[model samples]
Target: MPRIELKTEIKANKNIVFDLSRSIDLHKISTEHTNEQAIAGKTNGLIGMNESVTWRAKHFGIYQNLTSKITEFNKPNYFADEMVKGAFKEFKHEHHFAELNEGTLMTDFFIYKSPFGILGKIADKLFLKKYMTQLLTERNRIVKDFAESDKWKEILA
Candidate 1:
Protein backbone atom coordinates (compact mmCIF):
# COMPACT_ATOMS: atom_id res chain seq x y z
CA MET A 1 0.00 0.00 0.00
CA PRO A 2 1.06 3.58 -0.71
CA ARG A 3 0.41 6.28 1.87
CA ILE A 4 0.02 10.01 1.43
CA GLU A 5 0.29 12.25 4.46
CA LEU A 6 -0.73 15.89 4.62
CA LYS A 7 -0.80 18.44 7.42
CA THR A 8 -2.79 21.65 7.32
CA GLU A 9 -3.00 24.46 9.83
CA ILE A 10 -6.34 26.13 10.25
CA LYS A 11 -6.82 29.25 12.32
CA ALA A 12 -9.79 27.90 14.14
CA ASN A 13 -10.88 25.73 17.03
CA LYS A 14 -10.30 21.99 16.85
CA ASN A 15 -13.97 21.21 17.31
CA ILE A 16 -14.99 23.37 14.37
CA VAL A 17 -12.22 22.05 12.19
CA PHE A 18 -12.98 18.50 13.13
CA ASP A 19 -16.67 18.84 12.44
CA LEU A 20 -16.01 20.62 9.18
CA SER A 21 -13.59 17.94 8.17
CA ARG A 22 -16.28 15.28 8.54
CA SER A 23 -19.08 17.24 6.98
CA ILE A 24 -20.47 15.62 3.87
CA ASP A 25 -21.66 18.95 2.49
CA LEU A 26 -18.17 20.40 2.80
CA HIS A 27 -16.75 17.42 0.92
CA LYS A 28 -19.17 17.94 -1.92
CA ILE A 29 -18.16 21.57 -2.20
CA SER A 30 -14.47 20.75 -2.03
CA THR A 31 -14.76 18.13 -4.77
CA GLU A 32 -17.06 20.07 -7.04
CA HIS A 33 -14.47 19.88 -9.80
CA THR A 34 -14.72 16.10 -9.74
CA ASN A 35 -18.50 16.27 -9.49
CA GLU A 36 -18.36 14.16 -6.35
CA GLN A 37 -21.59 13.50 -4.54
CA ALA A 38 -22.74 11.24 -1.76
CA ILE A 39 -25.31 9.06 -3.47
CA ALA A 40 -26.36 6.78 -0.59
CA GLY A 41 -26.20 6.18 3.15
CA LYS A 42 -25.44 9.26 5.24
CA THR A 43 -25.44 11.70 2.36
CA ASN A 44 -25.27 14.86 4.45
CA GLY A 45 -24.37 16.26 7.83
CA LEU A 46 -21.44 15.18 10.01
CA ILE A 47 -20.63 11.50 9.55
CA GLY A 48 -20.11 9.52 12.72
CA MET A 49 -18.58 6.25 13.82
CA ASN A 50 -19.83 3.10 12.10
CA GLU A 51 -21.71 5.13 9.51
CA SER A 52 -21.20 4.49 5.83
CA VAL A 53 -21.44 6.59 2.72
CA THR A 54 -21.36 5.83 -0.97
CA TRP A 55 -19.89 8.48 -3.18
CA ARG A 56 -20.09 8.77 -6.93
CA ALA A 57 -17.54 10.85 -8.69
CA LYS A 58 -15.86 11.32 -12.02
CA HIS A 59 -12.19 10.50 -11.82
CA PHE A 60 -9.86 10.06 -14.78
CA GLY A 61 -12.82 10.36 -17.16
CA ILE A 62 -14.59 7.45 -15.51
CA TYR A 63 -17.49 7.59 -13.12
CA GLN A 64 -16.67 5.59 -10.01
CA ASN A 65 -18.65 4.82 -6.91
CA LEU A 66 -16.85 4.13 -3.66
CA THR A 67 -18.48 3.03 -0.44
CA SER A 68 -16.62 3.66 2.77
CA LYS A 69 -17.38 3.06 6.43
CA ILE A 70 -16.17 4.93 9.45
CA THR A 71 -14.16 2.24 11.17
CA GLU A 72 -12.85 4.29 14.05
CA PHE A 73 -13.80 7.57 15.65
CA ASN A 74 -12.62 9.69 18.53
CA LYS A 75 -14.44 12.97 18.72
CA PRO A 76 -12.41 16.07 17.82
CA ASN A 77 -9.20 14.09 17.80
CA TYR A 78 -9.09 11.20 15.33
CA PHE A 79 -11.12 9.16 12.87
CA ALA A 80 -10.56 6.55 10.21
CA ASP A 81 -12.55 5.54 7.19
CA GLU A 82 -11.99 2.27 5.37
CA MET A 83 -13.15 1.24 1.98
CA VAL A 84 -16.07 -1.17 1.94
CA LYS A 85 -16.07 -1.31 -1.83
CA GLY A 86 -14.29 0.79 -4.37
CA ALA A 87 -11.87 0.87 -7.27
CA PHE A 88 -8.94 0.17 -5.02
CA LYS A 89 -7.88 -3.19 -3.70
CA GLU A 90 -7.63 -1.59 -0.29
CA PHE A 91 -8.02 1.92 1.10
CA LYS A 92 -7.92 3.55 4.51
CA HIS A 93 -7.98 7.22 5.41
CA GLU A 94 -7.08 8.39 8.87
CA HIS A 95 -7.72 11.95 10.03
CA HIS A 96 -6.08 13.50 13.07
CA PHE A 97 -6.58 16.87 14.69
CA ALA A 98 -4.61 18.61 17.39
CA GLU A 99 -4.97 21.98 19.05
CA LEU A 100 -2.18 24.38 18.19
CA ASN A 101 -0.88 27.52 19.83
CA GLU A 102 -2.97 29.63 17.50
CA GLY A 103 -5.46 27.24 15.98
CA THR A 104 -5.60 23.60 14.95
CA LEU A 105 -3.33 21.17 13.15
CA MET A 106 -5.11 18.72 10.86
CA THR A 107 -3.30 15.73 9.43
CA ASP A 108 -4.48 13.20 6.88
CA PHE A 109 -3.06 9.73 6.31
CA PHE A 110 -4.35 8.06 3.18
CA ILE A 111 -3.20 4.55 2.33
CA TYR A 112 -4.36 2.67 -0.73
CA LYS A 113 -3.48 -0.18 -3.03
CA SER A 114 -4.51 -0.31 -6.64
CA PRO A 115 -5.96 -3.36 -8.40
CA PHE A 116 -4.55 -5.43 -11.32
CA GLY A 117 -1.27 -6.07 -9.49
CA ILE A 118 1.70 -5.00 -11.64
CA LEU A 119 -0.37 -2.86 -13.96
CA GLY A 120 -1.78 -1.03 -10.97
CA LYS A 121 1.67 -0.53 -9.51
CA ILE A 122 2.77 0.94 -12.80
CA ALA A 123 -0.20 3.29 -12.84
CA ASP A 124 0.44 4.33 -9.24
CA LYS A 125 4.06 5.05 -10.05
CA LEU A 126 3.14 6.89 -13.19
CA PHE A 127 0.29 9.10 -11.91
CA LEU A 128 -2.08 7.58 -9.37
CA LYS A 129 -0.14 8.69 -6.31
CA LYS A 130 0.09 12.23 -7.54
CA TYR A 131 -3.58 12.28 -8.46
CA MET A 132 -4.67 10.99 -5.05
CA THR A 133 -2.37 13.39 -3.24
CA GLN A 134 -3.71 16.28 -5.26
CA LEU A 135 -7.26 15.36 -4.37
CA LEU A 136 -6.48 15.14 -0.66
CA THR A 137 -4.57 18.43 -0.78
CA GLU A 138 -7.45 20.18 -2.48
CA ARG A 139 -9.86 18.81 0.10
CA ASN A 140 -7.69 20.04 2.97
CA ARG A 141 -7.34 23.43 1.35
CA ILE A 142 -11.08 23.77 1.25
CA VAL A 143 -11.35 22.68 4.88
CA LYS A 144 -8.71 25.20 5.89
CA ASP A 145 -10.50 27.92 3.99
CA PHE A 146 -13.76 27.15 5.70
CA ALA A 147 -12.35 26.71 9.16
CA GLU A 148 -10.42 29.99 9.14
CA SER A 149 -13.45 32.00 8.23
CA ASP A 150 -17.17 32.20 8.98
CA LYS A 151 -17.98 30.01 5.99
CA TRP A 152 -17.93 26.96 8.24
CA LYS A 153 -21.03 28.22 9.97
CA GLU A 154 -23.08 27.44 6.90
CA ILE A 155 -22.17 23.80 6.49
CA LEU A 156 -21.57 22.98 10.14
CA ALA A 157 -24.54 24.73 11.68
Candidate 2:
Protein backbone atom coordinates (compact mmCIF):
# COMPACT_ATOMS: atom_id res chain seq x y z
CA MET A 1 0.00 0.00 0.00
CA PRO A 2 1.09 3.53 -0.76
CA ARG A 3 -0.07 6.58 1.13
CA ILE A 4 -0.11 10.15 -0.07
CA GLU A 5 -0.92 13.18 2.02
CA LEU A 6 -1.56 16.73 0.90
CA LYS A 7 -2.42 19.89 2.84
CA THR A 8 -3.42 23.34 1.82
CA GLU A 9 -4.74 26.48 3.48
CA ILE A 10 -7.95 27.87 2.07
CA LYS A 11 -9.23 31.36 2.74
CA ALA A 12 -12.51 30.20 4.18
CA ASN A 13 -14.05 28.79 7.32
CA LYS A 14 -13.84 25.12 8.07
CA ASN A 15 -17.47 24.49 7.30
CA ILE A 16 -17.37 26.34 4.03
CA VAL A 17 -14.23 24.58 2.90
CA PHE A 18 -15.48 21.20 4.00
CA ASP A 19 -18.83 21.64 2.31
CA LEU A 20 -17.27 22.77 -0.93
CA SER A 21 -14.71 20.00 -0.91
CA ARG A 22 -17.35 17.32 -0.60
CA SER A 23 -19.75 18.88 -3.08
CA ILE A 24 -20.23 16.70 -6.15
CA ASP A 25 -20.74 19.75 -8.31
CA LEU A 26 -17.58 21.29 -7.04
CA HIS A 27 -15.70 18.11 -7.79
CA LYS A 28 -16.79 18.30 -11.39
CA ILE A 29 -15.74 21.92 -11.65
CA SER A 30 -12.35 21.40 -10.09
CA THR A 31 -11.10 18.60 -12.28
CA GLU A 32 -10.96 18.63 -16.02
CA HIS A 33 -9.60 15.13 -15.91
CA THR A 34 -12.80 13.64 -14.47
CA ASN A 35 -16.39 13.46 -15.62
CA GLU A 36 -18.05 12.45 -12.38
CA GLN A 37 -21.64 12.23 -11.28
CA ALA A 38 -23.31 11.21 -8.09
CA ILE A 39 -25.32 8.23 -9.25
CA ALA A 40 -26.76 7.36 -5.84
CA GLY A 41 -27.34 8.59 -2.30
CA LYS A 42 -27.89 12.32 -2.01
CA THR A 43 -26.89 12.90 -5.60
CA ASN A 44 -27.39 16.62 -5.60
CA GLY A 45 -26.75 17.63 -2.03
CA LEU A 46 -23.97 17.51 0.51
CA ILE A 47 -22.75 13.96 0.96
CA GLY A 48 -23.99 12.69 4.29
CA MET A 49 -23.04 9.85 6.57
CA ASN A 50 -22.85 6.42 4.89
CA GLU A 51 -23.82 7.84 1.51
CA SER A 52 -22.42 6.24 -1.62
CA VAL A 53 -21.70 7.42 -5.16
CA THR A 54 -20.25 6.10 -8.38
CA TRP A 55 -17.78 8.12 -10.37
CA ARG A 56 -17.02 7.51 -14.00
CA ALA A 57 -13.85 8.94 -15.37
CA LYS A 58 -10.88 8.46 -17.67
CA HIS A 59 -7.63 7.64 -16.00
CA PHE A 60 -4.40 6.63 -17.72
CA GLY A 61 -6.25 6.83 -21.00
CA ILE A 62 -8.72 4.22 -19.91
CA TYR A 63 -12.28 4.62 -18.74
CA GLN A 64 -12.69 3.66 -15.12
CA ASN A 65 -15.63 3.47 -12.78
CA LEU A 66 -15.23 3.73 -9.05
CA THR A 67 -17.90 3.29 -6.43
CA SER A 68 -17.23 4.67 -3.01
CA LYS A 69 -19.14 4.92 0.23
CA ILE A 70 -18.78 7.52 2.87
CA THR A 71 -17.73 5.42 5.82
CA GLU A 72 -17.17 8.30 8.23
CA PHE A 73 -18.42 11.83 8.19
CA ASN A 74 -18.25 14.59 10.81
CA LYS A 75 -19.73 17.84 9.68
CA PRO A 76 -17.34 20.77 9.35
CA ASN A 77 -14.45 18.64 10.43
CA TYR A 78 -13.63 15.35 8.75
CA PHE A 79 -14.79 12.59 6.43
CA ALA A 80 -13.58 9.31 5.01
CA ASP A 81 -14.52 7.48 1.86
CA GLU A 82 -13.66 3.87 1.11
CA MET A 83 -13.71 2.26 -2.26
CA VAL A 84 -16.29 -0.46 -2.69
CA LYS A 85 -15.26 -1.18 -6.26
CA GLY A 86 -12.48 0.34 -8.26
CA ALA A 87 -9.20 -0.31 -10.04
CA PHE A 88 -7.08 -0.48 -6.96
CA LYS A 89 -6.79 -3.42 -4.64
CA GLU A 90 -7.86 -1.09 -1.85
CA PHE A 91 -8.50 2.61 -1.55
CA LYS A 92 -9.32 5.01 1.26
CA HIS A 93 -9.42 8.74 1.33
CA GLU A 94 -9.66 10.82 4.48
CA HIS A 95 -10.35 14.54 4.46
CA HIS A 96 -9.75 16.85 7.42
CA PHE A 97 -10.52 20.50 7.93
CA ALA A 98 -9.48 22.82 10.72
CA GLU A 99 -10.16 26.49 11.24
CA LEU A 100 -7.10 28.70 11.57
CA ASN A 101 -6.44 32.40 12.06
CA GLU A 102 -5.88 32.91 8.36
CA GLY A 103 -8.30 30.36 7.05
CA THR A 104 -8.99 26.65 7.11
CA LEU A 105 -6.35 23.99 6.95
CA MET A 106 -7.49 21.28 4.61
CA THR A 107 -5.71 17.97 4.58
CA ASP A 108 -6.19 14.85 2.52
CA PHE A 109 -4.81 11.39 3.13
CA PHE A 110 -5.03 8.81 0.38
CA ILE A 111 -4.09 5.17 0.72
CA TYR A 112 -4.17 2.72 -2.14
CA LYS A 113 -2.72 -0.58 -3.20
CA SER A 114 -2.04 -1.59 -6.77
CA PRO A 115 -3.05 -5.00 -8.11
CA PHE A 116 0.25 -6.31 -9.37
CA GLY A 117 2.22 -7.97 -6.62
CA ILE A 118 5.79 -6.82 -6.06
CA LEU A 119 5.67 -4.95 -9.36
CA GLY A 120 3.14 -2.66 -7.73
CA LYS A 121 5.55 -1.90 -4.93
CA ILE A 122 8.25 -1.09 -7.40
CA ALA A 123 5.97 1.12 -9.43
CA ASP A 124 4.76 2.89 -6.30
CA LYS A 125 8.31 3.56 -5.23
CA LEU A 126 9.44 4.63 -8.66
CA PHE A 127 6.49 6.72 -9.83
CA LEU A 128 3.06 6.26 -8.33
CA LYS A 129 3.83 8.12 -5.12
CA LYS A 130 4.93 11.26 -6.91
CA TYR A 131 2.06 11.00 -9.38
CA MET A 132 -0.48 10.75 -6.58
CA THR A 133 1.09 13.67 -4.76
CA GLN A 134 0.94 15.82 -7.87
CA LEU A 135 -2.66 14.94 -8.46
CA LEU A 136 -3.58 15.86 -4.90
CA THR A 137 -1.66 19.11 -5.18
CA GLU A 138 -3.62 20.03 -8.26
CA ARG A 139 -6.86 19.16 -6.52
CA ASN A 140 -5.91 21.30 -3.55
CA ARG A 141 -5.01 24.20 -5.78
CA ILE A 142 -8.37 24.05 -7.49
CA VAL A 143 -10.22 23.78 -4.20
CA LYS A 144 -8.27 26.70 -2.76
CA ASP A 145 -9.08 28.83 -5.76
CA PHE A 146 -12.74 27.92 -5.67
CA ALA A 147 -13.04 28.49 -1.93
CA GLU A 148 -11.35 31.88 -2.02
CA SER A 149 -13.35 33.19 -4.94
CA ASP A 150 -16.97 34.26 -5.32
CA LYS A 151 -17.34 31.44 -7.85
CA TRP A 152 -17.89 28.89 -5.13
CA LYS A 153 -20.56 31.02 -3.51
CA GLU A 154 -22.41 31.42 -6.77
CA ILE A 155 -22.24 27.71 -7.47
CA LEU A 156 -23.39 26.81 -3.99
CA ALA A 157 -26.19 29.31 -4.09
Candidate 3:
Protein backbone atom coordinates (compact mmCIF):
# COMPACT_ATOMS: atom_id res chain seq x y z
CA MET A 1 0.00 0.00 0.00
CA PRO A 2 1.08 3.57 -0.67
CA ARG A 3 0.12 6.52 1.48
CA ILE A 4 0.09 10.16 0.43
CA GLU A 5 -0.37 13.04 2.80
CA LEU A 6 -0.87 16.72 1.99
CA LYS A 7 -1.71 19.86 3.90
CA THR A 8 -3.24 23.04 2.55
CA GLU A 9 -3.86 26.35 4.29
CA ILE A 10 -7.00 28.16 3.19
CA LYS A 11 -8.02 31.63 4.18
CA ALA A 12 -11.60 30.65 4.95
CA ASN A 13 -13.88 29.22 7.56
CA LYS A 14 -13.24 25.64 8.63
CA ASN A 15 -16.81 24.63 7.91
CA ILE A 16 -16.72 26.17 4.46
CA VAL A 17 -13.43 24.51 3.65
CA PHE A 18 -14.71 21.18 4.88
CA ASP A 19 -17.85 21.45 2.80
CA LEU A 20 -15.92 22.44 -0.30
CA SER A 21 -13.66 19.43 0.15
CA ARG A 22 -16.66 17.14 -0.14
CA SER A 23 -18.49 18.93 -2.93
CA ILE A 24 -18.99 16.85 -6.04
CA ASP A 25 -19.17 19.85 -8.33
CA LEU A 26 -15.89 21.20 -7.03
CA HIS A 27 -14.25 17.83 -7.55
CA LYS A 28 -15.35 17.73 -11.17
CA ILE A 29 -14.04 21.22 -11.72
CA SER A 30 -10.69 20.38 -10.16
CA THR A 31 -10.32 17.24 -12.23
CA GLU A 32 -11.46 18.76 -15.50
CA HIS A 33 -8.22 17.66 -17.09
CA THR A 34 -9.11 14.04 -16.38
CA ASN A 35 -12.76 14.51 -17.35
CA GLU A 36 -13.89 13.10 -14.02
CA GLN A 37 -17.63 12.98 -13.34
CA ALA A 38 -19.89 11.54 -10.69
CA ILE A 39 -22.04 9.22 -12.74
CA ALA A 40 -24.14 7.80 -9.89
CA GLY A 41 -25.02 8.23 -6.23
CA LYS A 42 -24.70 11.71 -4.84
CA THR A 43 -23.77 13.02 -8.25
CA ASN A 44 -24.16 16.62 -7.18
CA GLY A 45 -23.78 18.74 -4.08
CA LEU A 46 -21.98 17.90 -0.85
CA ILE A 47 -21.81 14.30 0.26
CA GLY A 48 -22.59 13.27 3.80
CA MET A 49 -21.71 10.30 5.98
CA ASN A 50 -22.53 6.89 4.50
CA GLU A 51 -23.27 8.38 1.09
CA SER A 52 -21.50 6.82 -1.87
CA VAL A 53 -20.53 8.31 -5.22
CA THR A 54 -19.55 6.50 -8.39
CA TRP A 55 -17.22 8.48 -10.59
CA ARG A 56 -16.15 7.83 -14.13
CA ALA A 57 -12.99 9.36 -15.45
CA LYS A 58 -10.15 9.05 -17.90
CA HIS A 59 -6.72 8.55 -16.41
CA PHE A 60 -3.61 7.70 -18.32
CA GLY A 61 -5.70 7.47 -21.47
CA ILE A 62 -7.82 4.74 -19.87
CA TYR A 63 -11.42 5.14 -18.78
CA GLN A 64 -12.18 3.95 -15.24
CA ASN A 65 -15.03 3.97 -12.77
CA LEU A 66 -14.57 4.26 -9.01
CA THR A 67 -17.13 4.17 -6.21
CA SER A 68 -16.38 5.51 -2.75
CA LYS A 69 -18.46 5.72 0.41
CA ILE A 70 -18.03 8.14 3.24
CA THR A 71 -17.26 5.90 6.20
CA GLU A 72 -16.70 8.60 8.76
CA PHE A 73 -17.65 12.26 9.02
CA ASN A 74 -17.56 15.10 11.53
CA LYS A 75 -18.54 18.50 10.33
CA PRO A 76 -15.72 21.07 10.29
CA ASN A 77 -13.32 18.55 11.74
CA TYR A 78 -12.77 15.42 9.73
CA PHE A 79 -14.18 12.98 7.19
CA ALA A 80 -13.03 9.73 5.63
CA ASP A 81 -14.03 7.90 2.48
CA GLU A 82 -13.09 4.43 1.37
CA MET A 83 -13.32 2.79 -1.97
CA VAL A 84 -16.31 0.52 -2.45
CA LYS A 85 -15.39 -0.49 -5.94
CA GLY A 86 -12.58 0.75 -8.13
CA ALA A 87 -9.44 -0.13 -10.07
CA PHE A 88 -7.39 -0.35 -6.94
CA LYS A 89 -7.26 -3.30 -4.60
CA GLU A 90 -8.19 -0.95 -1.78
CA PHE A 91 -8.17 2.76 -0.90
CA LYS A 92 -9.07 5.12 1.91
CA HIS A 93 -8.85 8.89 2.00
CA GLU A 94 -9.14 10.92 5.18
CA HIS A 95 -9.73 14.66 5.20
CA HIS A 96 -8.98 16.68 8.30
CA PHE A 97 -9.58 20.35 9.00
CA ALA A 98 -8.61 22.69 11.79
CA GLU A 99 -9.20 26.37 12.40
CA LEU A 100 -6.19 28.66 12.29
CA ASN A 101 -5.65 32.33 12.94
CA GLU A 102 -4.98 32.82 9.25
CA GLY A 103 -7.87 30.53 8.27
CA THR A 104 -8.24 26.75 8.02
CA LEU A 105 -5.68 23.98 7.87
CA MET A 106 -6.80 21.15 5.62
CA THR A 107 -4.97 17.85 5.56
CA ASP A 108 -5.45 14.89 3.25
CA PHE A 109 -4.31 11.35 4.11
CA PHE A 110 -4.65 8.86 1.31
CA ILE A 111 -3.73 5.16 1.17
CA TYR A 112 -4.16 2.72 -1.67
CA LYS A 113 -2.99 -0.60 -2.99
CA SER A 114 -2.89 -1.67 -6.59
CA PRO A 115 -4.20 -4.96 -8.02
CA PHE A 116 -1.14 -6.91 -8.93
CA GLY A 117 1.29 -7.57 -6.10
CA ILE A 118 4.78 -6.90 -7.43
CA LEU A 119 3.77 -5.24 -10.68
CA GLY A 120 1.60 -2.88 -8.65
CA LYS A 121 4.57 -2.00 -6.49
CA ILE A 122 6.52 -1.20 -9.62
CA ALA A 123 3.73 0.92 -10.99
CA ASP A 124 3.40 2.80 -7.73
CA LYS A 125 7.10 3.48 -7.60
CA LEU A 126 7.21 4.43 -11.27
CA PHE A 127 4.33 6.88 -11.60
CA LEU A 128 1.05 5.85 -9.94
CA LYS A 129 1.95 7.52 -6.67
CA LYS A 130 2.96 10.74 -8.35
CA TYR A 131 -0.19 10.68 -10.45
CA MET A 132 -2.36 10.22 -7.39
CA THR A 133 -0.48 12.99 -5.60
CA GLN A 134 -1.09 15.33 -8.51
CA LEU A 135 -4.77 14.55 -8.41
CA LEU A 136 -4.98 15.32 -4.70
CA THR A 137 -2.89 18.46 -5.12
CA GLU A 138 -5.21 19.66 -7.83
CA ARG A 139 -8.26 18.99 -5.70
CA ASN A 140 -6.76 20.81 -2.72
CA ARG A 141 -5.77 23.75 -4.90
CA ILE A 142 -9.38 24.07 -6.00
CA VAL A 143 -10.60 23.82 -2.42
CA LYS A 144 -8.20 26.51 -1.33
CA ASP A 145 -9.11 28.78 -4.23
CA PHE A 146 -12.84 28.39 -3.70
CA ALA A 147 -12.70 28.64 0.05
CA GLU A 148 -10.68 31.82 -0.14
CA SER A 149 -13.12 33.51 -2.46
CA ASP A 150 -16.86 33.77 -3.23
CA LYS A 151 -16.63 31.01 -5.81
CA TRP A 152 -17.59 28.42 -3.20
CA LYS A 153 -21.14 29.77 -3.21
CA GLU A 154 -21.57 28.69 -6.82
CA ILE A 155 -20.97 25.08 -5.81
CA LEU A 156 -22.37 25.02 -2.30
CA ALA A 157 -25.37 27.16 -3.18
Off by over 4 Å in 2: 36-42
| lDDT of each residue in 1-157, candidate 1, tens digit only | 8999999988999999999989999999999999999999999999999999999999999999999999999999999999999999999999999998889999999999999999999999999999999999999999999998899999987
Q: Supply candidate 2's per-residue lDDT for 153.
A: 84
Worst 10 residues of 2 by lDDT: 36-45
For each candidate, what is the lDDT?
Answer: 0.95, 0.81, 0.95
Model 2 residue pairs with clashes: none
Error of 1 at 130 (Å): 0.2
TM-score of 2: 0.90
lDDT for each residue of candidate 2 in 13-86, tens digit (9 for 90 to 100): 77778888787777666556756556655566567688888877776778888888889998989999999998
Q: Any runs in candidate 3 off by more than 4 Å, and if so which?
A: none
| Arranged by TM-score, best first | 1, 3, 2
- Two-way lDDT contest, 2 vs 3, winner: 3
Per-model TM-score, in order, reads 0.99, 0.90, 0.98
User: Lowest-lDDT window of 10 residues in candidate 3?
Assistant: 98-107
Model 3 TM-score is 0.98
Candidate 1 versus truth, CA RMSD in Å, comes to: 0.6
The alpha-carbon RMSD values of the candidates against the true structure, listed in the order shown, are 0.6, 1.7, 0.7
The global Cα lDDT (0 to 1) of model 1 is: 0.95
Candidate 3 per-residue lDDT, tens place, 1-157, comes to 7999999988999989999999999999999999999999999999999999999999989999999999999898999999999999999999999988879999999999999999999999999999999999999999999989999999888
